[model samples]
Target: MSNLAIPKNKRVIGQRELVALTAFMMSLQALAIDAMLPALDEMARELGVAEGNQRQLVVAVFLLSSGVGALLPGSFADRFGRRSVAMFCITSYALLSLVIALIHDFTLLLVIRALQGVLSAGLMVLPATIIRDRYEGDQMARLLSLVGAVFIVVPVLAPSLGQAVLTFAGWRWIFVVLAAMAGMAGFWAWKRLPETLDPLDRQMIELPVVMRNMTHALLNRSAIGYVLGTSLLIGAVFGYVNSSQQLIGEHFGMGTWFPIVFGGTAAMMVLSNLVNSRIVERFGARRVSHTGVLAFIAVSALQVLAAFRHDGDIVYFLPLMATNLALLGFLGANFGSIAMQPFAHIAGAASSIQSFFRTFGAAVVGLFIGQSYDGTARPFAIALLICSVLALLLVLYSEKGRLFRRLNAPAKPETKPGGVY
Candidate 1:
């Protein structure tokens, strides 16, 4: 007798709808962060923040809590279901926003924001698990890259939108906007988003099984390597986000125009991911992502050199930053899909662990980078190089001493990108 496999009963939907839905779900976290950015200065002023740098805590604390908060949702999604946990997260996130709008004290606001990050994680982490449940291989990478196209829209518009809200209304309205984004996404999800995890694929809520899954995910070299590598890259992004206002507004005097400059750079990333979606099948994730990493390193070095020379103005800095950001757009989707490739059986736990490391570890390093800001781009530039180098080293480890080699051959077996031993 020969054994073959059977496909699970999945609720089929068009690819465009899935991409749009997943992109909206993933954008919830970005909306939470970016939508408040333009209001940070006024927020600091009203909240009585003592130092200029301390203003960054507005973004930092939420991300820290988000990292810690992500540890559980993946397991919950595994045991309960993806849609329920996501809806719960959206509701909790909206409620917390309501609280944040009413709070007057800075300390209390930070605490609530952290809690919201914990609850909002379902919107952040579950999308990855949902994608993993539905697709694998190059198809998964391609879908994720398309999803990135949608994800990039929030950053491009959020700062400007927040500024518009702050222009006439109170800063509190910004949180209201964040809440609105969540509510809209939640409503759409409720109406249209089908449950992706099949009954057979669901994991039992058992202590022993949780331990086994965690151990397996951590011990896998390729998975951990990808997790660590992506963490550094993500940290670079967080670092920039943390210090962007100070760099662009305070240092460069692009205060009101910060949104246009920031949005323009972000739009470049949107275009890059769109291009990646088309070419990823021909080049494979490793080839495309590795090339982006190399490009990132070169840009980082150039950024550092330009910073020291003082030879260039926005002409020099803008293009380098745009190029670096575009390359990052290339890395995020491919790296994530590659890392999650191995953990189909425990996709939720795996997604959680990977996100925990990527989110928390990057936040820690990003905090340091943000704090290191001193009216110079040197710190940001150095952090970028360090992150890129470390990520490349991990990529080498994940590849078992190989670089840019073809990972999948359908007919002939090979050790897979995220495959567990």
Candidate 2:
């Protein structure tokens, strides 16, 4: 099983199994992030968090730790094996979730949550590296799109699940459920997932080497642009996730019905993922992503207009929010794939650095924007607009002013002197 060579004729993984595993792995992040939303107020009250904004620190702390985790896990996965690292990470995360559930104090809870993020980063980075190891070009995009389609459903259901747990048990029970889910996921990976990294390709994990590689990724124009572009897009998403429960429950007078509304909007993202999958083979990732970015800008602009015009009515709010989020599914997968296109040799390191910047950077930006919750959707909409603009600009720059170019362009074989990627 360790050295099972995937034949070109036989599929790397059965489509159904690949979708199932990817969905499960990807859901780790969504469940961790989204399920906490409904419980934020309750947790804050329970812990006596001083500022309403401080509750957001719980989420921010997790993402910040994810950034730290993202940088190093890639090298470990490359050196060891994807399956081993993934199982270890998930087991750690599940244990941390249990710790979070048991914690009574706010500071301790934050520390536990951050550790959970660090552990969860293995799930996030290893899957993409495995996908790359298995597939490339259109096939890779299709696989990612399939995973994206499934991943969207997690967020759709998470808040609803959180609300249900809140109703029957308590907020602590939500973390209990998360711990159970993480344990199950880790067990599945250990039992079913095959190692994809080749021992010959493994590199010595060194601090200087990791730092040098990271600096190369950050300084590379295309990599930098893709990182920033994805970060901004993620920032918008984080802002929404942070505020959705409050807006729907408190402002829109939805209460328990909040998850239904939230889930409904989230379903639209599935539609977007389906659309991306359909067109990615024909039109390619860059074209599809560019169109998505433009659409996001338009949707955000309209939301801003409607907010100013009607003072944030739910009638105008829901549709705009749905459209904005739907567009995110389009940006999420393609940007990472495209960014890593040039860094195949050190895919693990590149993945780690890119994931760190995108997730943690987005968390920082989103936390800042989310703190300005004025009992309206205006701030969220405005943040989306700004992120969209920045993302669009960076995408243009990343593609060397050719935003619509197909991602399948033949690689230039010339090596850059001393470049780590």
Candidate 3:
């Protein structure tokens, strides 16, 4: 059905429902990572992963697979239906999770984790494409922020959820829980979700066409800058995720309270996204994102300074990290919209390619920085500062040095009567 066929006032699963679903889908990514953290030591011990760094492979392998998976799912979504593609991905992911859970050999576990990542690629891109199919500008931003707000809750509770499952059962139960979640998501899509892709608008998934579309997307200077900027932003967060447990557990001596600290910081992200939902319409995405990048830079800089000054107190560190994370709520939604603004023709492929770079690039950078861990938060702090600075520069360049001015500008005139701007 054409988006126009859906009535503006039709109280169906509109933007809010779409956001809720997207949030659920995005939460899968977080759950996959955080839920495994508490189980890492046990899994390592059972599988004989040898070194601490080797244990990280379980996480890194998934991320790597996610990136590679991201590259093709968008094209598939465009050619097929969003709901169908999503169901397929989730089903595959659930099967992979089952494999990861039942396997005893370490190499098999790593291979399963990688396959799980590949399956998750569809989960990452389809929700955004579905949302993009229906909204733009402030409406899109608000929807994304709402989803972002809801998605943050996953990370906040994931570790504790994992711990609870572990306490009751065993480490393998974590994957079992993940399988249940994926199965639930698949059923949700099958039941409540409609096919968002119109048959006439569908594009074939071919290498030449994929390359051409990607090249076109890259050739657009604004899109390129935004993509790179968003990748760096994601890189910072990924680095933090990779290092957070060790930093809190080993360095801060908060092994038991690690979930509390991590969850608290994640809560800040939820709060910030809530705020972004309210203000992004008035202040504009560009303005909000620019300000957020600046705030992140300031917070990251302070973290680095504190680290050097021997004042790396948890009280100070947590607050700073929270502030930095909160800004990501703004950056994540805005950067995504900006990168996608010019590609309405191939929204699915555009979303896929954007996700590929954002997830894959961030994973690579994050893994590199995470490997440099030396039982201190300094590496994470320094990495955050560097990423923020780079993101700011890219945003500035993308906006033609008019980042603040463009953000505060009046909304573009509506193109159609009763259209949500």
Candidate 4:
């Protein structure tokens, strides 16, 4: 049966609307992170922070909490519905933004940011869950790539948008802008997002049942391998995000031009995803993503060599770094879709579990990378290569030493009341 064999009522919208809405929902997280880059210095200053590197904590703490937060919402979405959990997350994210804007103490701000991340974890998990509820395999990878193509726009533009706000209304207004954007996405979601979980597939909220489901998700060999692989890759990306402002705006001295340079690099992500969206259906997720992993390792090596140069020419650094990020565009959606290929019955729990590993593990790894910054790009570059190599090893394990082979398995077949499994 077609995965798209959703009931007419549940398939409430067209493909374009579904992609747009999901992308917007996911982009909120990106906006919250990337848009705050330019404001970190001022935020640190007003909050009376002394060390320059400590400013990275504002983003780091949010990411750490977000990792922990990923564990909750999916189980609820599985029990209640995707829409309700999603709306709750969006509303809370907006409110938290407002609350954080008014916070004076740095500790208080970090606490609030952590709370916001916990709630906002749904923003990351639910969209993928929602997509999984409707698609699978390479088709799923293509759709996710399309969603990523749209979602990457937030990162491309967010630093610039934040800089614009910082130029006029000050940094606090950046939170206001985030609140407004969340409100908008939430409104659209409230009105248009369908409950994708079929009633028959709904899992109970009981602890044992939830644990069993999560255990199944965790134990799946392919899923865990891909999940860990993506986590390392995601950590590498977050490492860059954690130090982007410092590296580009401060060390390389782009200063006010940081946004443009950052956005330009981010634009590579947008382009890569767009290209992946177009070709993934033909080449398969494993082939595309494995190739990307190799290229990422190669590029990271170049980045490291460039970092050691006396001049550390921005000319060489920017392109290599951008290429590495662009490679991630191919890996992210494909790895996620492949990890999710086996869990049609427990999409929500599986997504939640996978998201927890991907986000939480990445957060820890990213923190290490960020804190390792020594006013040189060497640490970040080395982290990228190490992550890519480790990711390739995990992928090899998942594929049992194979690469570029298709995952011929479909999701476990379902049995409706009148049908057989």
Tens-digit lDDT string for candidate 1 (1-421): 0011223334455678878887887887887887888788899999999798888888878877887888888888877888899899989988899899999999999889989988888777888888887777667788888988888887777777888998889999988877887789888888877777666556767776766676676667776777898889878877887798888777777889976787787788889899999988889888999899888999999988888786326677888988998998789889888888777767788888888888878878888899999887778888989999999889889888787765675212122222222
Rank the models by lDDT, top first.
Answer: 4, 1, 3, 2
lDDT of 3 by residue, 1-421 (tens): 1252232331356566678777888888889988888899999999878898899888778877888888888877777767778888888888888888889999988887888888778888887788777666666777788987888788777888999998999899999899999888877777778776656556756677777666665556677788898888888887887788888777777789986787778787788889999998888777888888998898999999877665436876877888888889988988887777666556688888888888778877887778878877788889889998998888778777776755333233222111111
TM-score of 2: 0.84
Model 3: residues with Cα > 4 Å off, grouped in runs: 1-12, 45-53, 245-257, 371-382, 405-421
- Model 4: residues >4 Å from true position, as ranges? 1-11, 37-58, 101-109, 166-172, 244-258, 302-311, 373-379, 408-421
Best by lDDT: 4
TM-score of each: 0.86, 0.84, 0.87, 0.87
Model 2, range 44-81, lDDT digits (tens) per residue? 99999869899988877786777788887887876676
* Winner of 2 and 3 under TM-score: 3
300: Cα error in model 1, Å: 2.9
For candidate 4, write residues 86-200 as lDDT tens digits: 9999999999999999999999999999999999899999888888888888888988998989987877778889999988988899999999999999989888888887776
Residue pairs with colliding backbones in model 4 are: none
TM-score of candidate 4 to 2 decimals = 0.87
Displacement of residue 187 (Cα, Å) in model 1 is 2.5
Report how far off residue 183 is in candidate 1 (Å): 2.9
Candidate 1: worst 10 consecutive residues by lDDT? 1-10
